[model samples]
Target: MEILADQTPLPDAIDERLRSQLTFVIEVDRLKTVLRQSPLAAAPRRENDAEHSWHLAMMVVLLAEHSDEPIDVGHTIRLVLVHDLVEIYAGDTPLYSASTDQQEREEAAADRLFGLLPPDQAVAMRALWDEFEARVTPEARFAKAMDRLQPLLLNWMARGGTWKSPGVTADVVRARKAVIGEASSALWEAGQVLIDEGERRGWSRSGS
Candidate 1:
């Protein structure tokens, strides 16, 4: 039998223009996010962009068994990992910020960060980022649903509104879950369960 070899290009020094890629690694201290619970089992009260991405990566690996839908687990994992790379440039946006101009700002930030890579890498990465943003494809939808669901679960488990620093209400939480419904009815139902229990037990404030 003849052998078929894999062909892949080796990575060389990425060049000067790719310096924009370093923005993601520049460590934006202003990008604070997700409050931590002092007693989070194995990992306690550690909140940062790196930690958030790490958790999302693990969520894709560990909770995938409960997806209730066949999906590319690897792709889901990648999406979660790359989803927030833009935060490096755009900075983290609070979930409940009253500012009416966030969308435009974040979108512009996405352009700057994703546009920094090599043309090919930048295109692929941007497409994946955009797909995650659009939340229309099956993989993208599932990924987005989890992105929202995880914080809510963490806050509830963290003893109520730990991450909802701006004040989260049951109705507001429900509205967040409502979008998940369009993505996956099953996961959305699960979100409802979490939200309902959170409200009943005061993990999230009711009618706040």
Candidate 2:
């Protein structure tokens, strides 16, 4: 499918708004190509951005009751879905990669990808992405928690997945996964239990 730029003319048969929407739909399909650091439980390859986002969305539906505060599950799902769409352009930045300019890179990607939509949709999609990043609302906080939790689950199942990568230690996992507590104390406690077990099993590296 040809992704026409904003200035490009649309075919007479289709509306400009529909053309822009379709272009955006096609563009975001690239998200399936952006691979993440966390390995999948059922597959040998690492999970892609699309799979990660979908898993988080399902987590919101199944685990919303564990959220510290009441949240709109529907809105939380939307937050998770939009959260990673920018990765299509910015590429997945591994949690432990420690890249200093991640926010800047993602912000620019958000602009370009969301700009593919019509004016109103562009604003709405950008708003969802920003909300997920800010994590101020209950839904946003819960969505962010699920985002952190998903990788933790994967890594644990993968016998330390990214946890086995260089520079990662039990302490680093604790520090990175602490955000899960901000949304759900229950999930945070469970994740801590997993880390403890992982450490004992030699699956996770030790020391700070």
Candidate 3:
């Protein structure tokens, strides 16, 4: 068995370009350490940023058909993969937690993390992250849909995972998750069914 370590030496023949690329790749490994509030269905521990991004990428592949408009699945996958790399430095901000400085922290993290790559690759990576943040493109919108839907599914499976938090209610969940409908009506409708059922089961409260 082998472990991945940033200290591993690169070949002497590797140029500065490849060196920078590998450095950026190693830096992103830190995302695995940044955990989120959503718990894994099979485990009590919370999921990490890396796992969440991977899940979104897979969701993009499997659920692109549900998007409101046509989207390039590959591009959307790139959006999901790049979306959370900033959390390597910015850290995960729970969806329900209020944070006035999250955007500021993430922007700084993006600059430092993405800057580790070669200039061209850095620009491309930053572009993907920015596009996802903007949520303007069809792929970006659908990527966001998958991002929101993943946690919603996880919470339902965990019997109101995040919904168990103080002040979280069915209405709050639906309001926060309504963005899912902006990209995928089908998923939003399905999510609404889950929220309604969750409230009925007392997994979540009726109001704040």
Model-by-model lDDT, in order? 0.65, 0.91, 0.90
RMSD for each of the candidates: 9.0, 2.3, 3.0
Worst 10 residues of 3 by lDDT: 1-10
How would you encode candidate 3's per-residue C-alpha lDDT over 162-202 as one tens digit per residue? 99998788999999999999999999999999999999999
The residue pairs that clash in candidate 3, if any, are: none
Candidate 1, backbone clash total:
0
Q: lDDT score, residue 98, model 1?
A: 70
**lDDT (Cα) of model 2:** 0.91
Report the C-alpha lDDT of model 1 over 42-94, residue by residue, as the tens digit.
45554676567667778777766666566788998888877876676566676
**What's the CA error at residue 200 for candidate 3, in Å?**
0.5
- TM-score of each model, paired residue for residue: 0.74, 0.95, 0.94
Query: Model 1 Cα displacement at 189 (Å)?
Result: 3.0
The Cα RMSD in angstroms, rounded to one decimal, for candidate 2 relative to the true structure is 2.3
**Each candidate's clash count:** 0, 0, 0
Supply candidate 3's per-residue lDDT for 41: 89
**TM-score of model number 3:** 0.94
